[model samples]
Target chain A: MSAKQDNSPNRIDTKRLTLYALLVAAAMVFSYIESLVPLFFIAPGVKIGLANAVSLLLAAKGRYKGAFAVNISRILLSALLFGSAVSLVFSLSGGIVSLIVTVLLHKTKLFGIVGISIAGAVTHNLVQLAAAVLFFGGGVLYYAPVLVVSGIVCGLALGTLDFVIIKKIKTNL
Target chain B: MKWRDFYIIAAALLIAAVFLCLFPGSGGKTVTVKQNNETVYTGSLYTDKEVKLDGNTLVIKDGVCFMKSAECKNKVCVHTGKISKKGESIICLPNRIIAQIE
Candidate 1:
């Protein structure tokens, strides 16, 4: 077995990895901005999920792993920067559920950016609520009605934003 | 812009509607406080008072219950505002305290 493989293939992979890292950083910045917005007054763990824009963009480009990388990093980093262990659990659960939903919906090819974003947003809230129930107690599910409605509105807003951004900028990745 | 997109949105809205309907509705006059899977306090929402727990405080006033203060880093419960309707709750996840209308 050779100690070193060909460097050419690794070069392209490195570029992609670099791009993924940049995307992760950008997503983290968005997450920080989102944290600054006082949306917690509306509901706990509720936001427009702006960092998802990066994930949505990557997923739209059919880069599922890259999208996941950006999303998980954004969640973990934001959880460390602006949240607690409880919030980390919520965000992790929400991020994983939403990422899976977005990826699955994107694979269908029948829906557009807005559709996938909405799917991801809804699932994210649902999974977070499930997490709240598991850790905080069943009574926490009482907040479901308001959370569901807020999720739809926020998801639609984010989806429209994603749609416009995706339409304006063509991705070759 | 596509029909499929509308279909997806409609489906999401329908699911949300179902969730809204399925959630326990308003009209509950009693408020129950649970902490760490234990029923710590149960009382009427009409009563105006406060219940202080480990590093957290619940305040009831004018038939609404809210998190007055908490040692939790996020203070999300405090930001949840007041809950006056049935099926509404204020949860302090770090303290595992949930004040819900019953």
Candidate 2:
């Protein structure tokens, strides 16, 4: 009962809660926008991953809990709203794995936001590719080179966008 | 972007380049089709053939292999166009089909 007190150490502050909610909303909006665009014309699975920017921003701010919550909520809500069960599985796996890598890289403090974002993006694609191989077969690995290259390109663009956003919002946050 | 960011990008690009070299898509003459990781069809790429699977139709003609049609929600496999070189593949996740050049 003592742990459930309002002043308990585990309780999330109103400010943090509101911030996480806003982050999740932003992530969902980005996901919807991305789905509207047909980047698959260029490649079967290439996407700008604009939604990940919110997670990247939270992670950069050292709000790991907020980042994880935002990422999971965004994926689940997006899947429920506009995606299928198959896509849900793919996004869940990719989102979780990439978040873990991003957090670890951020902890290293050796790389900048761009580097962390690139790592996150690359791992996300690789994990999704692994899921595809599991469902399809070894032949899917043939598409690895393309995914890797696309991950780098998309990650770079996303990272730069995140950097600018973070800079502008740093004072406010 | 910092210098360290460039290094990460370089490493990633190097890995991709290595993969590209490893799976050289040249001098391939045969197309192999697999379902659920099992080989269902293997034939010469030049020999025109239409393979009908549970929910996918693979067509090989003029030294190229492509998914002529698929009953999946996303027509990604069908839109993958054609593969004529070695190490190239068209995968239909929903149908669990993989058509590759070897």
Candidate number with greatest lDDT? 2
Residues A5-44 of candidate 1 have per-residue lDDT tens digits of 6575323365687888888898888877876886977766
Backbone clash pairs for candidate 1 read none
Off by over 4 Å in 2: A1-3, A6-11, A171-173, B25-102
lDDT tens digits, residue span A1-173, model 2: 23455975545777767877887998898888987997987878899899999998888878777788899999999999989999999999999999999999889888999998998999899899889867654445656788888899888888999899887765433
**TM-score of B chain for each model?**
0.71, 0.72
Note the chain A TM-score of all models in turn.
0.87, 0.92
Clashing pairs in 2: none
Could you say which candidate leads in TM-score?
2
lDDT score of model 2?
0.84
Q: Note the DockQ of each predicted structure.
A: 0.22, 0.29
Model 2 chain B worst lDDT run, 10 consecutive residues = B20-29
